[model samples]
Target: MSDKAYDDRNNLGGRVRRYARVGGSVGGLAARLAGDRLFGMKIDRDDHAMELAQALGNLKGPVMKVAQILSTIPDALPKEYAQELAQLQAAAPSMGWTFVKRRMRTELGEGWRDRFASFDREASAAASLGQVHKATDTAGHALAVKLQYPDMGAAVEADLNQLDWMLSLFRRYDKSVDTSQIREELAERLREELDYALEARHIALYRHMLADEPTVHVPAVYPDLSAGRLLTMEWLDGTPLMRFTDADQETRNTIARNLFRAWYVPFHRYGVIHGDPHLGNYAARDDLSINLLDFGCVRVFPPRFCGGVIDLYKALRDGDEALAVAAYEAWGFHNLSRELVETLNIWASFLYSPLMEDKPRLINPADNPGQYGAETATKVHKKLKELGPVTPPREFVFMDRAALGLGGVFLRLGATLNWHQLFHDIVGDFSVEALAARQNQALAAAGMEGTVDGR
Candidate 1:
């Protein structure tokens, strides 16, 4: 093997084993403790869950990021697991100056210092696979330099394998949700996220799509300084999305409006969805506009698929089971049997409830189904248990993650608005022929196969 590949493999192998060992041990302990003296009690469960979360957080890799994502999706984990995994969303500890210097030297070579006017030795934010540093360009523009942690690609793959093992253990512990489909989807999304080049492209596409939308802001990427492993963009300042929760109702509504646009504009207009809708991926600006961050988990759909979503919503609103089934088939769920379709509709109806209603729908913190956030998720899991393994269509994966993830954020915000109105405005001009034309145009523009015409 080449020297570079050898180094990547060896370094990653060490981190993976460390994480698996730590996670496995914690899972075992938590299982035993739950079974013994403190099973099901709130405090005991909380303590046990928190201990596992901290262990994974300290590991600070794909394992931690996966845990954080799973935490947001109800029924993906128990209440305590979800609560504990929430802690992983906080800023990770940054690497020391010595390590940062080494990374720079490795990626930019020894003369990298001459390329920038100034580069901060310290990181502003440390995430799962990388950290962001504030830097100044020679042209006098402020920039955010995203430096990938060394050997992270391999580490991510390794961590995913370990996560698979942990999830199996989880399934045995709690058979509420069949997480295999979820895990596979997450693995693909996370792998794409690790590729910074893909992230740069996603960011650029979003910038172009959101240009006319004033309330939503996506950073302008500096392509000259970006590489497969590194990304640099204009630095943006904003508060976390959570801060808006305590603001006045009007202010909160304004923020939510921008958020609604920020999320749906791309999906409806361009067939691309920002797959990771965690609170950390968005920021609340002082001007009431929202700042969109992290393009790692973006999903691109065909225009036809986008239309399929609308068709399904309309079908559910009108109680047209035939049309609804057709929409699901269009979405690639060929195995959606009659009984399964009914159960699936229970969930789809809930998701489309906000848009189906004339007035605003309030999703208060108290109204939260809590651990059973998605009734369909529970029903589907039960069905899967009875019927055996169901091969989920690939296209369904990322969109589901994005939908649930975004819904979780809205739940946290507790901001109510006329969701149906905004949704309608996005796809007001929807047409099958027009959608097909646009889908082909986008595919040709991106130099990708044009087969994704909502098949």
Candidate 2:
């Protein structure tokens, strides 16, 4: 491997440093939980959960990202933990210019500054894994240069170990949702996010999937200036989606429609999804169009899984028990009992409720937009506990996450629309065979053939 590539991997020193940091921050919670479990001592879960969130929040990398993801999934973590972790943002403090200069030099050599007409010393934005710097290319075009933080491979490995321990501890206390598959799925995606070259391909794949989508924008990547740890792409000018939350109803609805198309059209047609639907991942233009950012957490699904999503929706809508069973089976759920199916349906119906109604309505009529799915999630969690453990298909992790994430966004916007018709407009003629064919064409066109199991 190249020296530059070696620098990104989990070196001995980096791994040690990461472990020390994570363990130092969270070791107290681990000891406390262990005491509670072994000695039958009672501890204030809410307070401990907050302490754990604060601990992870202070750390950088996939641990924080994993915490945020777990917070959204129902029963993945205890309610108190989820509530506190949900407050953790995808962002972190930016690295200094000295660090940025060294990173740029590592990515593009010592003369890296000459490639740009002008590059900002300060990062325009920062996130868990990387930070974005605004710059002007030699030809005077605007660009966003995303530089991956150093030793992320070590960080990811360390954080994933911590994640497994945390989940295992939770499992010892509660057996509602089996998190083994969730850990594996998150590990694969988190590792993938460390590779900017793979992310560049994801960007290409998204561009191919949404080429005809005029209302949604995907930035064009600059191959010459990009590297495994660095990505340079066309700069998209837009405002944060949250900024429009207080806008007029019509404006909010238009933005909502565009956001819906941007997220679903790719999944419905190409069998791929942008799994991280965090508000910061997208921005809205004055024209109401959205700029979809951060290609790292994308999921390219098997064609059958895509069909299964639609099948389950129809099964719930038409009250077909057998079809629901088949749909769940298609999604990799097996040996499901009648009671389990009924239990699963409670959550399914809640998700499909918005899509079932033909008239315009709010995504959730709840007064507190932030608590949109909390109650339903709690109900489902209770049922799952009674039904025993269910190992959710790995694919279901992000699919459910995206749904909940978008639902929260819609609730925040207070956008009203005929969701049933909007959903029908995309899946009116849905077929697994056609979807597979389209997915293959798009993947091939984007030079991502075999990178994902299109079948």
Candidate 3:
């Protein structure tokens, strides 16, 4: 190992420092609740949120990850905490050269330097879980090397405990939604991301699935050079998604159309969905094509679940209550009382409203620019409160998150299209049995388990 290379941040001393830093801040916030038993001196949730963000920002791994999770699940965090955590998704600190050298040695062994024609010392990009470095192979092919931060598994488990406490606090503020299932889902997906071998196969699966898609691209994984923590893939040169915001309407619309296909084609045609949508996961080429990056958070659902999504859309569009209830059941939602069903429909209506409208329009039709589905979310929250604590089925977590994240993307592009037509173009030939066959073949070929977290 190189000198002081690959710092053992997951070691006892390191973990203690991490926990102490966060616990000290959180402990102060929890003093009243701890002493008085959930209610005494009031905790300023917003202030507590800022302190938590500060604590996470100071640390390397867990806080940003937990923040990313809270950002996805609706009402999982208070607005203040969510916003703070959301920022951390893009602003993770990078590991220094010594750490990088040690990581490369571990992944590629002593002769790692000779394998690359050139490797940049500075990271091209960094996130909570890992950092990417630009490199060139001996044959001159550009590559992106993503190195997982050391001891991420340990840090993740430790921080997930803290996340539990954070969510408990959130539940105190809003008892409408029981978040235990959602937490389990987050933990499952986050742990899955640690397995780069699985992700490499996800890349292969996408390559096979999207072969005919002219507007979408998935990188080629280097299996020989990749380990459980390190992934090497062909570098995609493209502009960031937001860089197109100032582009012409036609260009923006084309980009949005491509994004729509890139995201949904796999879901409708197969039972897979890319679970993360943090904007950084995709980029736009000169012709407005998309480069799909990051396969770590892929979710492969049962074909029935995929069919249920469309069924719910059709039910909402046609106002078929019976179909809607069946679809809910298919999605694994238990005993849906009339009021709860009505509340869920309100939220579903917002998601499906775009496809119902035959005319071209903005995704978020509110008069003022707002968070996509903000009003709908608020209304649903109010209704859920009235209806009492509701357990959200596991499948709903990432599905809902990806939907809102994509809508936010469209709103940013200011794209206008007959969303109804676009949606139909994809869903017109949907078949449950066919998707089941396709999903099974894909899973078998990729050597992946059929269930997402044994669900």
Candidate 4:
């Protein structure tokens, strides 16, 4: 091969090697955590786990992003794993100037100087996979540039392999629980999430889908600056969702309404779901509109599934077991025996409790026994043990995550609203056929031309 060809091969080989190294580290860390927990092995579980999580967090690549996703979505990992991975949320170490410059030069041309009026070397925010920097284009449009770390796909795949091993260890440790569904769910979404180009398009799709919803915001994409690894968009300014406590009741309610639309308008109205529910993904502007960020984990479901969701809500409210069963079956639960069905109802009831009630939504601890969250987890584990493994068809994973993520935000705001009524208003005209038609139209317009049958 020529010298240039040899250099290209060598660079590719280096990337593969680095990915393997990180993958190996992930497996090693899981083993260490397991040994400490299981055998009463003289290991400081907290300190050691924190160290391992920090190491991955420091990497700030695909592995770290996966960890962050697992952290926020409860039951994706066992309790200890979730606890450790949760740290990755705010804990990812930012990339330094050296790496940032290298990445920018590669993404833009070496003379890419003319593209931007100014680009900040320092990152404004850092997370598991990439970092965002505030910049100004030559056209003077203030923008946020999300730059992926080089070779994130390789890192993600390697880490996922390690994560599979880690989940197997978890199953061994807790035989009562089968996490096959969670594993499948995370794996599929993580793959889609690794593509920044897909994410960029997701933003554009949302912009058009939610065009009339003033309370929710989606940033304008700059296609000229985006690629599979990099994204540039209009920078949105807002306070973090966590800061809602400082706002008053009306402000909180307004924020919640926007947040409600931010989360459900796509799924309920357009059949697309923003899968990542981390509190960081949304913000409340001074104008009271909710600004959504991070489109990497979008999950587009069959419109039938959304209709099934609404039907399920109606069933729970009317105490119609048959309707509930139809909805669950529609959502892809197979060979669901009567016992399994009943067991599921216990869990479903908790999830749909807000929608079932005639009163306004109040996520107060006083309202729930805190029993549903933990106890339902235990019950599901027991059922999985006895009734054979259950795989929660791929689509529900992110829907569940988004719901909890939004719930967490609501809990933070301590805002109460008539959730049942709002839900009814959205789905009152509920027809799976209509939803499918609208969704198909939206997807076609966005160049995502395909039909999604519930099956």
Candidate 5:
């Protein structure tokens, strides 16, 4: 390989290029913020936001990860930026065959092509950390080949540095929720996603946890062909979720039910959740069942945290303030005043309303399609503004991200369900110790190091 064949992302030159790309992309927004704050000039957030988003979309890296999570959090970014950033596709166009050849040789040796019956030179799918190519093994079994982008480790750190600056500016403008915890958590998850080895383990864990879930499918990992930066797995087939958005009501409802189970069964039973619920992470099958595609962003919660989620649900249903307080504390929220708790409960009520009702119904019936949680989020923002700063525990960020992301999917499907029964069945048999045991057992079975009792 030539010296310049692969970008030296850890070198000074690479760092300069990345930072320059990022700054050039969003410099206008930074200028707007600076002008609005320093020069006493008015700058609308909506101005050039789409162009800014388009600029970011043209590249793939940390900004996309940060923006994806921020989109799930209400009012984290100005509405225009959030909307535009949400539209940023997670994947960039696939790197060309030259890059692929170099990457394949690095991971699988010079004879890499001979290991497969045939490997597509073009990427079938691309995303922030890596792109996937469809291939077949020597035996002709279908496979998905995931190859990490070069120097992603360095790229992630560089992007996080830039993220720190942007987040600080955001804090300067709006201090409604202290996002330090959220930012740090996102950094950890994004770096973790760069590790295909860890992600392969996550895939194993999910397959084990959802073994009984006939409606959900998990792909099998191929250790022989997988490495720290490359992952090979069974190529599962399904349709992207958007294809089902305009389907018949029955079909949509069935798909929604399957999705809910796919997401929550892991959490309610094993204390693990698929942290990333972007539309690209899932696909629908002919039978209305769904395949969970991406396992790179899984989160394993403490058992006490899982218990607290149940406690909060019961408190909300029974109107028990004492239980609610305990739940909040268990979640690591400190310095909560009565008014603050009440303010938090206002948002909680809206999230839990669907499940509180026994009858089957749309997740957000009164609102128009694609408008799920818009009104409630605005109300929550207003209440939080009035009640003063409420620091969200780090755990809440991903939980809320996955929850809200799934809710958006439900809205897109227009699915109706007896959410109350679904909630009851999951929580009825729940025990803190049992969940801890289940979590530990599942992690151990998958060769993962996790103890639910660990802090």
Candidate 6:
């Protein structure tokens, strides 16, 4: 079907139905909050947060995913709300076999069943936006077929409107962070995720970027069996990363090291990152190699932004205030007051601290991995509140998310390594020009030319 056909399907009626369905829950919550404010009634924030989570949980879609993302970002939402929403899982109730059959017919053709040697009636895995089924191709290769939920375009538009309202409500109550850019960034990435064709390109991009890294694996996409709302790929067999926590220290460390390479190598080498590091997004083989999955939430950064990341690390390590300011400027931060810079450095130093140390050590020996950056985030949020609201550059959203998410994983595995050496191994010879060239070549090779900054 053409893009216009898809758009026509998700017309005004679809959007209105979605809004009514989602708003029934979220709108009620909004009303309650507004009532509390108007009546000057004391609110039990924790209770309301729980109610909010329950509401979003029941209506799984982009809003629920946004809640999960917000929970990880410090001060993105109230502490109570973040804690409650953090418990929101990616798994949602899967569409029934009847719906799957119809969707397959729509995406492929009436003879879709003939293309597959066999296809499971049940979903192998289900998430907010889509569900995956185990299948075998005509060539007898094991494949994972991802089918997007119906009306997702309409669902995304409605959810984004609801998200904007929720953020606005929070802003009215607290002004620690200006979430306007954050919303825009999330909306863009979420919209991109709806296109499985783009995700196919992302898979190619990762395969090319990590081709030299034997420890990391990227799945091969089957274009013939895929569509805008459906993706077919080589199915990888592995154990979830969380299951390896109790394994021998060596095994655990190996997994952690491989995971670190899987995530960071692409970022440092090509100015790209797997934005979402949720545990479910990857797994580990018996040989300790990593299988990176879910290419939906990928971010491509400008070469200069990648350079700024390294510059900020060095600035913090060497106490170079001048270079630090320049790095912030490169990252799109404007009008950085001495106080604001100092405040921002607090969070940056915390993230970069694990990498600055020269000796082998756990990522954060002092704190529980679950509460990895909560304390520091609270401190930073307090300072920002006092300093007035600051709009973090959109790129900061996933960059920070990747750091904190991976840090939590490293802490969980108790991976002891000279992080400084590991980091230097990648960026020791880094240059903006070199990175730009490599990024362009890799992107073009993957059919993603001119996507980021128009090259």
**Highest TM-score against the true fold, candidate:** 2
Rank the models by TM-score, top first.
2, 6, 5, 3, 4, 1
- Candidate 1, residues 1-455, lDDT tens digits: the string is 23253233336466666566655656675555446444553446677787878778777667787887777554566666776676566467887777766666666677877879999988988887789999988998889999876667677777777777767766765564567777887888888877787787677677777889989898988878776677999888899887777778778778888898999887877777887777788898889898987888777776657767888998998888888888887777766777777866766776777787776765433355233254456565576556654455667767765776777777767778888888888889977676566555654554444534444
Per-residue CA lDDT of candidate 5, range 10-31, in tens? 6666676778878777776777
Candidate 4: residue 238 Cα off by (Å): 1.8
Give candidates' CA RMSD values in order: 4.0, 2.0, 2.7, 3.8, 1.9, 2.4
Of 1 and 2, the candidate ranking higher by TM-score = 2
What residue runs in model 5 are displaced by over 4 Å at the alpha carbon? Answer: 1-11, 366-371, 451-455
Q: Write the per-residue lDDT of candidate 3 for residues 411-442, one digit (tens) a residue.
A: 87889988999989988989898888787777
Show where candidate 2 strays beyond 4 Å: 1-6
| lDDT digits (tens) for residues 41-127 of candidate 6 | 768878998999898898857888988888888888878778788778888999888878888888899999999999999998899
The Cα RMSD in angstroms, rounded to one decimal, for candidate 3 relative to the true structure is 2.7
| Cα error of candidate 6 at position 165, Å | 0.6
Order the candidates by lDDT, highest first — what do you get?
Answer: 2, 6, 5, 3, 1, 4
How many clashes show up in model 1? Answer: 0
Q: Candidate 3 at residue 397, lDDT? A: 87
Clashing pairs in 2: none
The lDDT of model 5 is 0.82
